[model samples]
Target: MFVQPMWLVMLSWAVLFVGLASTAVVVVDQFVLGYRQPVKVMEMVWPVNALYLGPAAVLGYRKWGRPQSPRWLDRHGSPPRRSLNARTTIKACHCATHCTLGVLIATPVTYGFGLEMFGSTLWPEVVGDYVGAAAVGVAFRYYTEARTGGRRAWAVMRKFFMRDLLTVSVFEFALLGWLALMHFVFFHETLRPNGPVFWLIIQAGLIIGFFAAWPPTLLLTRRGVETELLSTPQ
Candidate 1:
């Protein structure tokens, strides 16, 4: 009896739906309200994503650990250099779709769903924040391929590690920085208990965000090994 990899598919599907739906909701709400409430929307959508994604990530890593998902990776690595061919297109779609979803999830979890939002009855905010983090994953894959080259995604990931790292690091810091700044300047709230120490803490957060965003950025890029493993499944 051949065991199916349906679990992976299901998890990916859930992530895709949650991300697209959340992003759509935010877009619609913004159009209706006539403003860019990126943070509020993230707070609502990302938490739910994190709930599922965190587990999915663990399961996926375990399933693909050491051995790795050879089949998935092979589709990316195989040569003969096909352009938007059916197989290649699907692979690209998978990379782009899930990555975009990942980014959408990461954003809110880091910025909004901290201990402060813990007791608030606004559960949507918590849910949305993690969803945004997942979106970060999606965005990372999407932008890397789109900006570089889809067919050569793996190669680009390998050769341009620092460049890719910089891209995602900057993105993570900018979004968090913007959110923190808004809270401090507009809402007059401070993360630091000490007023004078607040600026230092914010600077530290900017630094941490870059660090947190780096590993995942590196993982997605380095996962190119998975392509080689996939094609020559051991």
Candidate 2:
């Protein structure tokens, strides 16, 4: 049996707790406050963000996740609404959050199966990341759109499949690029999927991925391929 260091164990538990607890808050808010109706794909996005962002995710929900209404307008005094570019950035962040959680879940499972699926040592892990991320991204879009009511079932499914493929590809591209650099250049060691260092590095990758996905998200939104959940207050 292998013994892990005390600090690493503690950090792992901490991350787990934060991930679960914060995700719960998003779920509860969605159901209790009826946020699920107005915010497209928010049911999945907020919870996924909570996994890595913890309390910051809660703050983001309050600030940007909720739909605008008269009561909200009166209280906040109608602050300048977010521009299309800003909303595009938020959507990209939401897409990246989904991918981050997916990769986190897939990494360990794929590692257990060994890395021999492809000729390259890291290819198997990369495949797992793409599969997991794409699966989650498409499923999330399906569920959210279904709940909100939409076009024909086949049409919704087809749209989401294309949307997620484009968004998740960009997200994974940036995320894996950063991880590859860290592993080959800076760390000079193989990354252990279950290790605390790997978690930290992946978190940074997710943040970078948000930026990388933004331009694509902007184009998608402008073309009406993707919908913005939060609206600018008028």
Candidate 3:
């Protein structure tokens, strides 16, 4: 019998609308206006980020993402080197894309099937999210390292996947905890993929997740993990 306050519900709708609009901006810029990234996966990355970050994601795409376009590289004749801060942001988002896809898939599957473990859907969702992220993370690593760099798959596993596992685990922590306490704890009955407030929680959680993961990603980048692979302009 609980109802979300009128202003809260309206705010949720407004926030979700902005996120959608932001995602559209990135899509139009990439697909329609042709500011496509040289790395095809980043086309997915940037827009997905916009789904949560709204105009801030668009701004990041404009600054860091746009310059990676082939057209820009051709005009400039070289890729401009980004600062450590910029590179760290890129690295976090690169890994975060995996987490995003994982959670998006997990949330619905758990909800739809009425799956639960340990008296909460969170446990199963966590498993699905982790497995999905690792699967995609390994695939991305294979593409970037084993296939592109010509390293052996095992070597790539040792070098990339291990580090990525740590990064993504840290990345997922805050968002997962947030959902557990704020969304699932109070509104468990109401929040679903079909609900706007669900996405509102997701949106806010991802922003928190971004901040949570940033520090470790920056440390890893400074230590020269995934540096060359992430640095490729093409």
TM-score of each: 0.25, 0.71, 0.89
| Models ranked on lDDT | 3, 2, 1
91-134 in candidate 1: lDDT tens per residue? 22233223334433543454444534544312332234334534
Q: Alpha carbon lDDT of residue 190, candidate 2?
A: 57
Q: What is the lDDT of residue 71 in candidate 2?
A: 43
Instruction: Evaluate all candidate structures by whole-model CA lDDT and list the values in order.
Output: 0.37, 0.69, 0.79
After superposition, which runs of candidate 1 have C-alpha atoms over 4 Å from their true positions? 1-103, 107-160, 190-234
TM-score of 3: 0.89
lDDT per residue, candidate 2, 1-234, as tens digits? Answer: 244557865776677677679888878877775555244466567787777777877777667665443345556664456778767866776687668767876777767766645344466666778888777766666665564576466766686667657877888898879877876676664567667666766766787887788788989988877533444312
Which residue segments of model 2 deviate by more than 4 Å? 1-41, 54-56, 67-82, 117-121, 148-154, 227-234
How many clashes in each structure?
53, 0, 0
Candidate 3 backbone collisions, by pair: none
- Highest lDDT among the candidates is held by which one? 3
Assess candidate 2 and give its TM-score to the true structure: 0.71
